[model samples]
Target: MRITVLVTAKRNPDLDGAACAIAYAELLREEGYDAAPLVDGNPDAEARFALDETGWARPAVSMSASEIVLVDASDVVGLPDAVSAERVVEVIDHRQHHDAERLFPRARIQIEAVGAAATLVAERWRAAARRPRGSTALLLQAAIQSNTQRLRGSVTTPRDLDAAAWLAGIAELPDGFVEGQFAARAAEIVADVDAALSRESKRFDHPEGSYVVAQLELPGAVGLVDAVAAADLARTERVMVNLVDVDSARSLLLIWDSAFRRWVAARLGVTFTGAGAECSPAVLRKQIVARLRGDAS
Candidate 1:
């Protein structure tokens, strides 16, 4: 009557989280565990595009598992309210700041600094000398690309490259699937700036102050930046949108706080002009927040 392991990620997860859930769950099942991947909320744009293209649908979760394994998520804040933190038995994440040790004191924790958590999951499959299904491999490969900005992101590692290369051989994907997946998410952000911002935004603690960082990866993100700025919504929190141009391997930080902008510039060595500043991919939102946590971000 109990599902042995329910692997999951943050609510409304991106491609990296969703793919890690499915592929990692497959690895668990292969090892004779009664496992299932639970996507507690809707998948983000890139994730939805990947699943739909691959003809895979996220499971309708029941939350009846005996144990929980967080794939891309590590903090209690990112998980669903229905999920019991105490039941978490394992965590595989790529972020530095987490409640993993405190909330899941009894759980096994594996946190790395790789670009994608999917990189870690792919390593797990390899360690067991197993091969995921073609679809799973494709999804994992796509997740690596998405999280790594086509493998050009700041957190990208040799292991990320190794995982993607290994999965590519097994993926057998269509010629344009990866590019299409990336384009779909960027187009969605251009279409609905408000929705995208609300969905993709995450709060952060900065040494200068507290701010929310919303991220989007688009080829030419200046127009999208203008659109988000013009929305005129009642934004109560200090928010900065870090728009990454994957094509250029650069980031544009959009903010209105002049003093805080100077602080960001000094901390990150980026110059500002008007409402936005063009910087390297090292200006990733989470990476910036980790700076406050004493990481050399």
Candidate 2:
């Protein structure tokens, strides 16, 4: 059957969603499935998919043309109403929980709080006795290692470790390469505190209840810890910074403003809790919406 794989990632170079999609598509093709990887919201439709910097052409065909669609659930916030596909499948993801039944009722939901969706795909490949060769296996191995922080993050479960071990055996990844990449990336943060803080920004939304979230992607030349510290220092209002390491599944929640900070610390079980005076983008958006609605909460 003809299948179209929808892959997505936060607009960050480090996340490597396109690479994972390419690898998975190759494996699927080897299995005799006509599979092609499509970037979820790509504006271009001709150029082959690449990292954030690469240009891609938007596919001209409709989603209904495919017999089946596999979506990278990590970055699929909402689906277009124009999509009339009969069958849609979801792959691995670790985004915040949402109303899946209401959103995509026909989808095969598989949400695991793992580091990367590629890890989940790799497990599926192994279970099916699919031995991806050459570059496919190597890319999968890199995706897992980068997502798991070289196996240092708390989200690195036993299953993830197992998948990494198996893929590494076949791919033969160099020792300490992942760790070295992280270190090299961390050394790029300079003394410009404000610019560094701006590297990561957060937003909060209050649909009915207040929910806060942050997103950031530091390049190979930026230090995440320093950026987070700068974010904490720059807080002037009520907000929480959930700094997600797109490469490493590690995340740090920086709570500024005393009241909200304490509430999040107690409720969310944050690993690092402290006080500051910053406001997240989510909080700001909520406040604006509240003001516009003439409802003070």
Candidate 3:
């Protein structure tokens, strides 16, 4: 029997990663390939909101295909052990990695520096004169907007904005869609802060040490959790929880490790005056992880 084609993102995929995997697989299937999108791990809270908003099902946990297409991430370290570089037949990503060419030399690789991988997938669809419909369009649009922080994040590029504009044109979004989505996520956090934090938390290994970084959306500046709950959410030696007020584009950063606290204060050119530091220019958890890994010696 012929094996099916599996398209998936890295483990613990966020909005862009999950959306890209599903969208790209649909694109391939339209071209007559037996393709399916699977999630390497469970989606995060914000990603779940997008899934629920579009009525899309959560991705299957595993793929039995021998050959696979990777989306949103290029580094082999981020992939599962069963998916080796040799099995990667193609790569689609917005984040650039130095080892992509070396790892998947024979695969058709696209590593653009856009804010979201969904932008790249949309560009491909537009090039083929194909428009995503219904849930796919909605999820992809939300992924673009969320990753770009409603087009206000520093990581956003012109291509990302263009893709978002195209997606918005096709998607049957509600009035004030972006704002409504953020508000929904904030409400979920308020309903259960512990569940929200646990779903959003991700860990990274740095030269200094391994640490957990988590984030949550808040309707306003009123979302607060006790230290015990915060500590319970962390599974690493150091942890940083960022409570982001999406409407205002600001974040309250709570740090646990003293060394990391000092490092972050120095890096951001700020002084730690209280329990947590308020970042005027809101920072995403992905940006924090990038900064942490990039600064490692």
Candidate 4:
């Protein structure tokens, strides 16, 4: 029972990762490829919200596939052992750290500096002279908006804006779709802090130590910093909680273990208060991780 091609998101996937995988799989299927989306880990709150709102089917985990197409991320660190470089047939990524051409030299690589991987997926769909329908269009649109913070994020590119606009036009969604989605995600996080944090956190194992980076956007900043679920991720060697107030475009960072906190503070040249540090102009979790790896683009 050999599967031809399987598309998967990196472990601890968020809305962008999961949506891009599913949407890209749809594109592959439309092109007469036997493709299916597989989730490497449980979906986070934002991903769950997208699935629920868009009504897209939940993806299964099993993968007995001959080839793999990775979306949203291209790093081997977060992927399963089964996904080797040879098995990788394609990779669509938006981050700077991944060199798909270098890692999977024979694979079809599309690594751009766009705000979201979904933007690239949308571009591919358009390039094929096809339009995504219903949930596919909605999910891709939502992914671009979420990743780019409704085109207000520092990393947002013109490609992302155009792709999102095209998707919204096809879906017949209102211009305020992003605001509604952002509000809903924040409400979901506020309703259950522990569930939200655990779902959003992604773990990384480095030469120095292992750590978890958790992030969630809120409607507002009130009472959010104190409500972070740092203790829930006790298994992690260190924890970094990013609390974003979407309404104000502000962010706060909370770190556990004084040594790690101090190290991060020194790196950013910020005050290491016992409470939490404010990240002015608000950086996303992806940006923070990139900075840590010295791969910020």
Candidate 5:
């Protein structure tokens, strides 16, 4: 069967979105299917998740026209509407409530708030005893390590840990390789106020609706400027934004035009700081949705 794999993610190569797409494509090919990876945006760009490399020509235009589209969950933001709803499928992901059912009711949706989708992919590989060789294994390993935050993120689960251990054994990585990878990723974040404020921001979906989680990743020291900017940005972005400095681990939640934020704040007993800004969270959410719809926002 003709299958097209679409991997979507924020424009960051350091992320694991592209690697996950490649891993998925390899698995599908082994299953006797014609599978190719199609990433959103310019394949030759330097941005994150971009597919720029020699011999990596633009994927055949017909690839997207295939009968099946297996999307990397991170790439969900860049999905096109031309494909049939029945053909769209998703790999495991950390994204919370999404509009997947409405867009692709036939999609084999698999969402897990765990370490990384690569862990699930690895599980599938082990179950099938389909050993990946050389580059494929390396790529998958990098993806798993990166997504797990080097086994430090709160999302890391037992399944993720088991998968990592198994993959490490099979891949036989050198000492400190995994730790080095995590350190490199962490170092990419700038130490400025923007970077600090952006670090804690996340996106999630709930039955009531979807919202953005903004947190601050600060060192132990609290700065008034960083805190103020984070609160302003959260309001301007229009989603429920929370700020937390990694050092203090203190978090501030700002819900837009809803009592939920207050309730959460009170329940958590964390004082809500910062003057509310004028940005609309609904607008920001809509923008994100539009981007996922393949509209250039």
Candidate 6:
């Protein structure tokens, strides 16, 4: 039978995107719809760790689907080849620099600036008055913790906090679970920073400029700025590297393009001592994009 809803995230989703896909698909199935979660590419190290910890495996999903629901993904570029823009019936994302409505014209869109898209999916479970299974709740809870840095990130919202709290009651996550997740991710990054950088990179085309932003997130990535060699990120196109310390809540932006560096310096009020500049209380990539596109208030 054809799948009614094929829920997915970006090409290689992190925990936030992967959790939303699986959890929202569960919600759809509970509502009596034929739905399943499918990721086009492999999830990142952090997501892999969570899936293993929760023992939440991906079930079979039909490649040909009647409709698609994109969670934590908004742009056409991130859409998998199997999911044509016309097939996307719904888009639920939490980013400011989004092209959801414009790209997926027929899709019902919800693009808020919340910390994690999983927060919205958790709210749906609460709205329906249906409790998710323990593993599902755990996944959503982990995603919120990762995205919001345990409710310390600047993008965190009250909705994120409430959803996390509700899920906490259901999940009963173990003590030091967040710490373990962070340590696992840090080991993966510190082992091979270049690969970590490549794994988490994303490209954007805003009205201000078209460029790519590569990110590395861990507890103390701020110290790894000089070792990152972010100056070589730009092969032909403009590229910027953001090394974010999620624990301490700091960001170090590495600029390879001098002209673009000047632009960012002017916009963000930062002076580059060398090729990198640090911003405390860390700013997310979406926030930078929002500021440049005038989406920030």
Q: Which of the numbered candidates is closest to the native, going by highest TM-score?
A: 1
lDDT of 6 by residue, 135-179 (tens): 999999999999887788777899999999999899777888788
Candidates in order, TM-scores: namely: 0.92, 0.64, 0.78, 0.78, 0.63, 0.92
Name the lDDT value of residue 174 in candidate 2: 58
State each model's C-alpha RMSD to the native. 2.2, 8.3, 4.0, 4.0, 8.3, 2.3
**lDDT at 102 for candidate 4?**
79
Ranking by TM-score: 1, 6, 4, 3, 2, 5
Which pairs, if any, clash in model 3? Answer: none
What candidate 3 gets wrong by more than 4 Å, as runs, is 1-3, 10-13, 39-49, 52-62, 75-85, 96-106, 176-180, 225-230, 233-237, 293-297
Tens digits of per-residue lDDT for model 1, 1-297: 435888999888888999999999999998888898987677877899899988887666667788989999888886876579889999999987776799899799999888899999999999999999999999999998888878887878899999999998887668988788878888888888888788777877656577777887876765576687875432444667888887777888887767766776676666789868887763577787776456764
Top of the candidates by lDDT: 6
What is residue 241's positional error in candidate 5, in angstroms? 5.1
lDDT against the true structure, each candidate: 0.82, 0.49, 0.75, 0.77, 0.49, 0.84
Tens digits of lDDT, candidate 4, 97-186: 655787887688888888899999999999999987778898888888788766776667899989988987888555665666676677
Assess candidate 4 and give its TM-score to the true structure. 0.78
Evaluate residue 281 in candidate 6 and report its C-alpha lDDT on the 0 to 100 scale.
Answer: 72
> lDDT (0-100) at residue 54 of candidate 5?
16
- Which ranges in model 5 have alpha carbons more than 4 Å from their true place? 1-14, 42-62, 71-76, 80-86, 89-91, 173-188, 191-211, 215-261, 267-297
Cα lDDT tens digits, model 2, 84-181, are 33445544454344444455566666766565667777777887788776455655666666555556554456877887788877777556545544
Candidate 3, run of 10 with poorest lDDT: 221-230
Between 3 and 6, whose TM-score is larger?
6
Question: Using lDDT as the measure, what is the rank order of every candidate, best first?
Answer: 6, 1, 4, 3, 5, 2
